[model samples]
Target: MSGHQMPATESVWDYPRPPALLRETRRITVECGGDVVADTTKALKILETSHPPVFYVPPDDVRTDLLRAAPRRSWCEWKGSAEYWDVVVGTDIRPLAAWSYPAPRPPYELLIGHVAFYAGRVDRCTVGGCTVLPQEGDFYGGWITPEVKGPFKGGGHTHGW
Candidate 1:
């Protein structure tokens, strides 16, 4: 919706810094290479300022067999270190398509064993039966559904925000 926030949609600016981890009951699903990689109704969503919510599905709900650890790691000031994962389905592979905070810091310890996928890296990701738009830029993993409005960070020129 560009710079304007739509009615009934949550503005990203209203989200908190350091992020808030909240339980989400909406169905979350991820598919890639013709297979459903993850599906869950019990997910945790990270709500951060200037970003759309990022959904994290418990490992038990994901097809962990299809994921291979990638030799990549990243740090989040609030969530702690993240380990990347590659999704492999037969001969098809999507590198570093998902990530998790195996040992999250305080206030984020609930993220342990939960995985979050990059919507842009998978064939499809749906929240409550609605396909989501990926947050812009390569780094952020936010999922943009109809209820979340944004002048989101991650797009070019928004890095300084």
Candidate 2:
């Protein structure tokens, strides 16, 4: 779909406006500066239209010490305002590398404290053993795995779409 390689897969267009959260049992790992910052088998994947799933890992599974809350905040109509976190691993500091919905809406209450990392900003982000490709824009934090085919919304030529 769009310009991306399309395999027999779920179309991002079919996703819902309020988004859907699915429990992911696959191994999700986020590594940065040669250190595994977050790894878990219990993650929640948020699915939205024109975007790949954004994996949200539980705070308990993540190395909390590595994340520092940033000053910036943004609003999401469906989820609520989001707060950013910088992933600092030794000398490597990825600014605003992750985000979470502090007080999400009723439908997304499960994401209250869950964190989702930017796949491209981190050294490596993998799902089910396959490295993921970050969604093509700075705003959206979708993780594009090989198993997911997308005409993702973000990056070039999609501003008006």
Candidate 3:
């Protein structure tokens, strides 16, 4: 990645202009440390396109202190075998809430080493003091933010996730 900083004029958002397949909602609260930025249920063909329901969170939004890189790894044809992270909270830890393709495929070069989180795993998923609603099944994270409006996962025949 070129390592260009995000433009100052642009608001920090995961998908500023999501594809026709995606819909996002945004809200900010406290989760990791600085803020609990929430974007709710997004993407059409999301499972097929974006590595299976994982919510792409900007690293700044997550609590890095609690995340420890783990030896465990898994691979995908698109991105390499992902390196895993174990999230530590208090004395307890959830083995996996984060993943990254350090050396990604050419098409996904922008996302290399950029971690994606599984909202389904982490225990504290709060947005604006309210614990956000978890989506059906193990959808990665379509955070619950008012900005998100969608039939993202429920459109006619949208199943097969």
Would you list the C-alpha lDDT of every candidate in the order shown? 0.95, 0.91, 0.48
Candidate No. with top TM-score: 1
**Sliding window of 10 residues with minimal summed lDDT for model 3:** 43-52
Residue 153 CA displacement from its true place in model 3, Å = 12
Q: Write the per-residue lDDT of candidate 1 for residues 77-115, one digit (tens) a residue.
A: 998899999999999999999999999999999999999
Write model 3 residue lDDT over 46-137, tens digit each, in one string: 23322223344445545667789988778666555678887776666667666767786655555554556555566556433445444444
User: What would you estimate as the lDDT of candidate 2?
Assistant: 0.91
Q: Give the Å shift of residue 67 in candidate 3.
A: 0.6
Candidate 2: Cα lDDT at 130: 84
Q: Where in model 3 is the C-alpha error above 4 Å?
A: 1-52, 124-161
Query: Candidate 2 residues 83-153, lDDT tens each?
Result: 99999998899999999998998788999779999998899999988899999989999998866777889
Residue 32 in model 3: lDDT: 40
Off by over 4 Å in 1: 1-7
Better of 2 and 3 by TM-score: 2
- TM-scores of the candidates are 0.94, 0.93, 0.51
